[model samples]
Target: MADYQQIFQVSRNQAIKDVKEGVFELSRSAVIFYPKEGSFDCVARPWLTEAGSRSARGIWEIEFNHKLLRYIYGLTNQFTTYSLRDCGSLRNPRTIRLYESLAQFKSSGLWVTTHAWLNDRFLLPESQQKNLAELKRSFLDPALKQINEKTPLLAKYSIDDSGKFLFSIIDKQNPV
Candidate 1:
């Protein structure tokens, strides 16, 4: 698919590998925390059936899970939106995750959560999780810088009295 070339700007060979990995990785379970609300623990069987690939086409032919489709298509009203262009160009994977988490709180322009919560969602390196300074220096600082530069969201963050991250995500598209 040109999506690999156009959106991600990756080489054909890299695209094939990425397509293969992404399809297989969906079978792995994940625990995602919502910045605004609850969490998701998806521990079900394979979300996609067969999930074979074509190297030439750089595509995975698979049967998607109905639940996954419904949730993604907004039937569940439990989804958030982000700029695909911005996400595709983002360098760090953590930046994309941070962007999505902040996107959910876009209406309020704020999100306050503990580092433990972010660790759980980002699944960051154990060393980073244990050390707050390292977490900020290694993960938070870089991700926030990317988010501010690449996305329409102007984000600023600080550690509150409770040692939780207080993020202010403001949409640059709409001026105050």
Candidate 2:
């Protein structure tokens, strides 16, 4: 008997292969916050899901809607799909599960990138490094009064700062 993981992989693999071969288009639209652009755009793509929801324990379940699958298919037809994970050590166990789950996919198309990750903490000067740590703490500190109480726009998506989202674009293929 096949496990749910195996079943999901089988179905997802076939979908990826079929789309890659140009049998049909796969596409979906997502409501994502783009902090750099300072705008929320309906990004159309082949498949979009909050990563690791399936493999994670507790309340988080992978939210897969048919609309997203279709859009993902269509988007894959045009541009390739890339996968990214949160940077640094796995602070959250649920996120770790998500990372591990995505790691097993057979598709060669997906490339791993670091999303909202501060690069090279060691590289910073001693004073600057201290500042960064303090900054991170300050951003995470709720007691500090902030303008955007709901969503603080921080530089580079630091939790210690008020940032919506942080994205590093490598290998840009025709910005959408």
Candidate 3:
């Protein structure tokens, strides 16, 4: 098996704290490229194990149906690879999901999606924001801030003339 090294930002200390306090919610999403369904949930299990004498560390293991894993890792051409650490560092689930989704288009450095898409994928309530501007102010900006500051990835977005969001990823090798 090939070793995959995608790190999530939750530190050992934080993980231990969360685990012990029973405050952790482990969530995973598998994005499907060409499909009737775009994404599906996967199970995550987090626990603490001894690292050394009088020391312990957190471990998070994900469980996926073999078919799903095969489809995601084997068959999908459109997929995002992100550090779990970065995702964990994000306070909002929407922000984390956005990061993972956008990371798929890092090579292009650009992604365009509609407000409706965001509303659907992030599970934003219809009563939450009345307009795009309000949505951007309340949700998008804060999420972008966290993604830029906490992760290796950086993002910026604009509302196009057609009212679609045009998001651009800053190239890590040549940041502006």
Please give the CA lDDT of all the candidate structures: 0.78, 0.33, 0.65
TM accuracy, model 3: 0.60
- What is the alpha-carbon lDDT of model 3 when measured against the actual structure? 0.65
Number of the candidate with higher lDDT, 2 or 3: 3
TM per prediction: 0.68, 0.18, 0.60
The prediction achieving the highest TM-score against the true structure is 1
Candidate 3, residue 99: how far the Cα is off, in Å: 0.9
Ranking by TM-score: 1, 3, 2
Tens-digit lDDT track of model 2 for 1-176: 12322433445545344333332222244445334553544443334344232222212234455655665568666653333222123343333333332333213323232323322312323453456555345432321222112111111222314533232222222322
**What does candidate 1 score on TM?**
0.68
Candidate 1: where are CA atoms >4 Å away? Answer: 24-46, 49-62, 65-76, 125-127, 174-176
| Alpha-carbon lDDT of model 2 | 0.33
Off by over 4 Å in 3: 1-78, 173-176
